[model samples]
Target: MSQPLTAVSLSGVTKDFGRVRAVRGVDLELQQGEVVAFLGPNGAGKTTTIDMILGLSKPTSGEVRVLGIEPRAAIARGLVAAVMQTGGLLKDLTVRETVEYTRSLFVDTKPTDEVLATAGITEIADRKVAKCSGGEQQRLRFAMALLSDPALLLLDEPTTGMDVEGRRAFWQSIRQDAKKGRTVLFATHYLEEADQYADRIVLVSHGTIVADGTGSQIKSLASGRVVRVTWENADTEAITRLGGVDDVEVRGDQVYIHAKDSDTVAKYLLTQTSARDLEITAKGLEDAFLSLTGTTDSTDSTHSTEGAQS
Candidate 1:
């Protein structure tokens, strides 16, 4: 297959706030029409990297480019739009007015009504931004971002504070945009959203990228195998005897075995008398994430397994 078109590229990028280093030696690439979910904990340098890419903050080192042009230049040409954490909408302005006002800034703007409808906010088009709840205000901002028909959309925690129905609505709209060859760089703390929306994922921790790949790829870093231990009268010693079992923890009657081949181990446990009632399952992405960033030392490579088993 032909190489994917590059929408955004950052090489050896670094950003510093005074004496503190926020983003260090970061290198990232976003492809045309691709959706990349940027994942990290609070203060993990996610926002800092996004700010640099958006030209809101200058990088301390290295180069950053968007759409073959600097992000600042892209913004000038109305090729990039951002949905920041604060929404940034005039509280008193109505939704239609907000979209219309932003549309005026761009020479080629999506029609106000069309933008409202695309964002699922047409019913509330005439409502003042201040009157809308947090989720509605966010949807309004999303409508404004699309008003310019930007090629690259930068979203920081876009679905935050939205109800389940609202989030589903927002993503449905975003998926339509992706189908049109628009690139999206989304920053979110919600891993499930990343798994669902992102074609690829970049995991950051402590001012550096710890992992970058598809959800399965990242999960494979720590091995994508869960050890589900079920027992009738599961004793701690009996649970530990299962071969290939790594970390074993018990809660109530269930024993959680973090292992490589849980299926084989569960069968092995079944042979033992203590494991008369036994069940074992596989691991998931959540385990990989917790084992990596959630551990005491974020850089530990103890659990770094190569490719995932699918």
Candidate 2:
């Protein structure tokens, strides 16, 4: 058979746990060698979606295919590998020992030493897993995932426990793997990471996809720009009444204005108020995400969609 043009295909997929609907009808298609970021706030069904994609959990309805085959069949062929966000580590083994043991699970495996080096953990090869820092352990997990050299790699919030430096180093290693023409999909809350690394992004909110596009395309979904004016006599309500303003927030001595046109907001602020420290900037992905989802990390609610999508 000819090679499938798609690396992953999900059609009308949904998942439920008892009474809770964790995923809605999520239809997505990813091509080979594409690096995609699956982004959402906590409890947005990101993990549930990944679980179904990995065949760890069955979908309640519809179908999921990886590499043009069912998820389980594709995984059984050693065509898929994942670096999960948590668990699946042997704490008692040293890094080298763990790599060796994990490699034994598959016939087509990379050398233990080579995998460790690729993951940037060669220097800590002898360190006990339990004693390693969170970042080191995460790298070890990544090394294990690479042992099979799978064509598709799935990473779920891969840098959750790392410091900023650790996150950067980890992405550098991942960047190399992605450059090798492997199809990779990673879930993350860090919008900047998605902006920097992913050629495409799929954003979920309330267990359903809200947006899917490249960084700039997603950002463009939000109209206009932002203008911030700092002054002691700013009127937050008056600014909200301006023709260009979409929303306004007031600080002690400043007002932040979200508007379709930054020029209009800035002009009004200058003409009407004695504002200083005026700045104008385009809307970022974070702003777009908030505007699209109608919520933020703080406002994430307990409500779940009921019996989503037949």
RMSD for each of the candidates: 7.1, 4.9
* Clash pairs for candidate 1: 225-283, 226-282, 226-283
Q: Distance (Å) between predicted and true CA of 125, model 2? A: 3.7
Give the runs in model 1 whose Cα sits over 4 Å from its true position.
1-5, 224-282, 294-310
Compared with the true structure, model 2 gives a TM-score of 0.79
Model 1 compared with the native: what TM-score? Answer: 0.77
> What does candidate 2's lDDT look like per residue over 41-107, in tens digits?
7777887888888998899998999988888988877878999766788888999999998788777
Clashes of 2: 0
The lDDT for every candidate, in the order shown, is 0.78, 0.82
TM-scores of all predicted structures: 0.77, 0.79
> Which residue pairs come into collision in candidate 2?
none
Which lDDT tens digits does candidate 1 get at residues 1-310?
Answer: 9676588999999876656667778999888888999988766777778888888878899998988888899898888999976848888888888888888888888777788887889999899988998778877777788878889999988887878997887788788888898999999888899999899999987777889999989888878355555565666675567666577777876777777767766666767545545554555777677776664554422122100100
After superposition, candidate 2 runs with Cα above 4 Å error: 1-4, 123-126, 161-166, 226-258, 261-282, 296-310
Q: What's the lDDT of the predicted structure labeled candidate 1?
A: 0.78
